[model samples]
Target: MTILDRLTGFANPAAALRRAVQLFDSGRPSEAFPLMAMAARAGIADAEYRVGRCYLEGSGVPPSRVEGTRWLGRAAKRGSADAQALLAALYVSGLATSEAVKGPASQRLFEQDTLGEPDFVAARELATKAAEAGSATGQAVLGYILTRGPGPMRDADAAHRWYERSAAAGCAEGRLGLALSLARQGGLAERDRIADEVRRAADAGLPTAIYLFAIFTEHGLGVAGDLAAAARLYQAAAEQGLPSAQFRLGLAMIEGSLGDLDPVAGEAWMRRAALAGNVEAAYLLGERNVKYRPPDYAEAATWYRRAAEAGHQAAARALGSLYLTGNGVARDEQEGTRWLRTAATSGNQAAQVDMANLALQGIGEADDTTNVAGWFEAAASSGDLIAAFNLGLCFVKGVGVPRDEGQAAQWLRRAAEGVAEAQYMYARILRDGRGVAADAQQARAWFAQAADGGILDARVALAEMLLNGRGGDRSPEAAVQLFERAAAAGHVGAMFALGALHSSGQGLPIDQVAAQKWFSAAAECGHGQAQLMLGRYLAKGLAGERDPLASRLWLERAAAHGIVEADEEFAEATSG
Candidate 1:
């Protein structure tokens, strides 16, 4: 039933292992696996290592780390340097063991036989032993540990030495590591050396090397820029299960940067990368689901949760927002707060602001002014203008901190450079000499900027300044234009100003009829001064036909509004 079933029996395990090596080298892994298993059962260390590799890679069997680790562990105990080095590599790559690996419970006879977490200390010891035994892969593993392992283990010079030794022994991973190290130095000679070494490693079929070479080609880093060639190399590495390469190829295809838009293939590749544990790919998938029309919010949440669990700050923020709003997920205030706090603690400015607002409004937490101000300060210090503006208001109103006019002015001034509300507030501070020297010119300038930004209150203030010549030269015409613009936007004070301007002929020819019309408009908007003036005008019939009843009604309305002058007008109209 198998290749080994019809073959003559090998004389010994050594002979069988030799034949298996030859068959495997010739690309007949299926035929080699039978012999390898036979040799492994006879306790041949190299055969055990090979069988383990076959299981891990699914070369002649379904991939199973639990089975692979069992074989590798046996060979390692038998002092097989290659097996020790391979186990070290697997541990470093987070593939040594996992609870996800499937097998019969009966198969897990020992603790180590079960797929469990990797142990870095054991990985380092195994790699050191194999390296001392002159295994090139072991040397490469040491280089990787020194270069990318935990903080205390990293040593750039030591990594370079290990990589150099491993490369001399002809390890593809060593060549790739050495090339990447040389690339960091950056020069023509280093560039050429890096390219040559990467090319050799890629030729040896190292997926990471191929991916790095593709990046070089794409960016013209150490080779001539060629997008087509880079795309081909990306595809090659992606097909070989390189998550980074898959991500790059997917992005390129999705954006049509490779001259062929294949959204179906691109999305499939993206999903593959995400499934392969590419955090950025997962986040990108979440963004795609959320940003498109008819958004699949549930799918977005799934991707976002994956990325967030892997420590993606933006994904955490987005997922938190979804939970808070019950979008695609049930509204869970506690869960939302937890995720948002994670994002905020990770230095996400927007999350900090969101958290602050939630605290202020008692949405997910009790209202805490101090906590709100602390969050605002954190975001404001990081250059969030909206937070800076809020912080300024907090200082001005003593909402969270003691009201300090000086601090308020300082914060408001920073926000005023971009925020219209802050500009208006800052201008008012300058005009009133609040915690600063009174500078009408500066106030007017800021008011003009705020007005241009569509602050109606700023427009009215600027118009008044122009009419009174408080900041610079008087310009009645400019004042009248500003007042009219504000009036059109429904500013009651602007209407009253227009009425007074027309009555006094300060900006235009005296037109009592026009004055009366503006007064009536302002009075309707509850301008008490406008009501009193309109009442007087009606009582004397200064602008139009006298109507005693109308004059009495206007005067009574003005008096009710607390305009003392309206009392005289009411008595005059009643007596007439």
Candidate 2:
């Protein structure tokens, strides 16, 4: 038989409890639970506390907070310091069941407050009793109550004295409490001392202390920034079953906040944390799955719905959009809009921007320019870049606001802080002196920014400016490269620019073949001038064998496009 199986058959409850403590300490709590319960049933105080802890945390048993509280109460009445400390915390937080906290009727706050309307008087009595009995946790908790003024008891000076005594007793919670209090009072040197105390508690393996230390390390607050160290601490805390730490570690991996991204590891951690009831982790899992290779929209919907039901506003918006587009579910625009409205009302900025877009496109039941502008304004105020851009356009076109160039420029400037397209728009206004002062140098800077951001129009515009010596220093070679980039991205104007540059040998050796190729590309895109030029090149055999039929065809096409010279050339080519 396994040790636990043998231990369960032992006649002596004391022996069973001893074996359970060994197993539990070795991280095999499942093997320890039955033994602990057996001893607890025989009235062993230590076993009772251990059993209560297991039930409270679902460590090795199905969690039952009520049962946990009952066992803890039994242990506390038997004078177990740990049990009294824990039971006092539950009462103070009002997390104990009504049956467990059923003191005299005078102590019952029957009304349901968010924290279940805990009986603070009872909590104080238990904490005071435990402290008087020399429980370090009890003393530290009593200090916390004083700080937070649980049930009209406020004594900061006494709280400080209690925390000092608890810390002297080697309690990590006491050290953590002192550290938090010191952080509020001290200058930089005091903050540094507080950090040392926090580190001490963390070294003692306090999960909350470790998690806070990780935050301090990651942000360089009162310590040198050490992302690697922060990640290690977070991992340690997560292993201790801290859901928030698990969520943090997952986000760090997914976003590469510490090092190279590891989406697989990130997703695994996120899934675990989500199952542990982390709404943010659930939302991130939905986002990741929605954009994963080949996508798992059904899985995305499931997670999003789960998080949304738990008050994750972004997940609500994502789920609504999925339903609207039928991405992973049936298309039900009415239902989708209802969810969207829910998210918007809950203050999700993206949802507000989405509502603005629907009104702008006249897609909603009450679509109107006024509603569109109002939603856009709300979203913009909440710092949404696209909403700011749309609001700028509305101001410029008087769509939902009076035409105000100054206001348009202001909003456009905010939008321009975000993306390539907005940068290009702002550059256009600067270049043309429209609704803003014309500053050729400033325009060039914005165009360069937009071009570097991979905007084809911005690339072509920047190239033209460089070639013409208008906005910046003239550099024909740079202009040629910019034109080539835009042309590769399928801009017909860029093709024409490349053809002209190659024909004229502005920054490169004359290459008739390259010139003809670029001219042909532009001509096929219905550029009349390019067709006429391509026709001339074909007729002249500039790059290869003459093709009379091809030349005549191009000339006729250009003439049809209103190129007068191409009409004359067409007449000449066909007249023979």
Candidate 3:
């Protein structure tokens, strides 16, 4: 006999398989897998089933669902009980429909037979065939169909009988379903017994069973709570690339519920889940990137688009914002409005607020005050802070609403409580006695708060008030400190104020040298007043030697920049 024939022990087929099974049981599925493949090729029924199972589970190499289904189909046709059960299970679970199943013949079957009508008759017939061959998984699948009735073949009694048989054969899913059904129907004692059987089946490697068991362990359902164990089970399923498990594991890592939170690892898991087409993961990744690390705007936009495509309202709004602001890509105002409108139609409050702003400003299209007011009202009704601020502006200015300073002040104060810009504007109202009694001390406090939040205008205004004693006590030294800070941050008014302070020696040592340098720097930065002052100092040699040419040049520039006194200075410097 040939060596292959000798190994099979048709001659030695049974003995060879026994040895392969021994190797497989000893964790040597690498060697066992090839031997099983050889036996399968030799038409050993049990070896065919084992080989297919190994391929399906990727026990010895990368998994091939298509190859696994084909081998299982061949073994099942030969009446192998294990193969029949596994094949039926795969079919019922939809895992058997691999890329290979998209061939013309399979497509025809799908379009003509499966898609055309409910075919419980055919499904039941196939299921019965596998069940009759002593396949527990097949019996369980048949039970599920009989209970649910894909067509007109509903029979709960038949379902119970099949489920009982499958449970007796150690099918974990069968036991779990039976237990859940019994629990729903008030058979509490039976439910408890079946739940234990389901646990045993889960321990033996059934993926669905493992997931259910994890849920039970985590929630302490009919068992003591064990979060750690539940986390481990979820991780195991995630490693197998199950999308739900991956999402849950990522959430646990992000929330630190499973231990120390790791944002990087959580982001990795979230990305994997998003790639697997989880809408929630896509939205979460987008939001996280937008809030924390916007350097990944392309990725953030992609995730936002995915969620938006799936009809997530918040994601659509976020995508609109990105498009409007050109966060990670070229700004497209038209596209931004489209997304904003989509989200607004979906009742997104933020989108309504944004739409109002865009409409009022004619940002992406023509101004539509009617639409703007409508969206603003909608946002305000939903308690949007920015919308309230905008509404106040509208009322105060009579842009789209009647002018009403009382209502405006009310809304402005509300927005100001949380927003720096609103705070500064509201402070102006109080300082100027507009619809409120003037309160210099309160105005200064508000200005200081806004300034501390990086509002450059607020800093300059506060510095001016301190320097001139306009709204509060005069403090030139304090004003100089504030002006210097604001000037360094590129505030033109603050630069002029600082130059004046150095030139006048008010609350500071007179330093003509420092004044000339400040004026020159400020003038180079396009501060008109500084340009005029620097030209005068250069022409008169107040700080150093005269440079009429430089002085005349600066004076000409200042005149062009709208400094009225610069024309006369320029003429005088040029004449001298």
lDDT per residue (tens digit) for residues 6-70 in model 1 = 25325577778888788789988888888888889889898989998998799877776778877
Candidate closest to the true structure, highest lDDT: 1
List the RMSD of every prediction in angstroms. 5.2, 11.0, 10.3
Which residue runs of candidate 1 sit more than 4 Å off their true CA positions? 1-43, 58-63, 97-118, 184-189, 255-267, 285-306, 316-342, 350-388, 473-477, 499-520, 523-576
Better of 1 and 3 by TM-score: 1
Q: How many steric clashes between backbone atoms does each model show?
A: 0, 0, 5
Please give, for residues 185-258, the per-residue lDDT of candidate 2 as tens digits.
Answer: 66476867778888989999999899999998999878899999999999999889888999999899989997
The TM-score that candidate 1 achieves is 0.79
Candidate 3: C-alpha RMSD to true structure equals 10.3
Better of 2 and 3 by lDDT: 2
Which predicted model would earn the best TM-score?
1
Q: How big is the positional error of residue 227 in model 1, measured in Å on the Cα after superposition? A: 2.6
- Report how far off residue 575 is in candidate 3 (Å): 7.3
Alpha carbon lDDT of each predicted model: 0.86, 0.84, 0.77
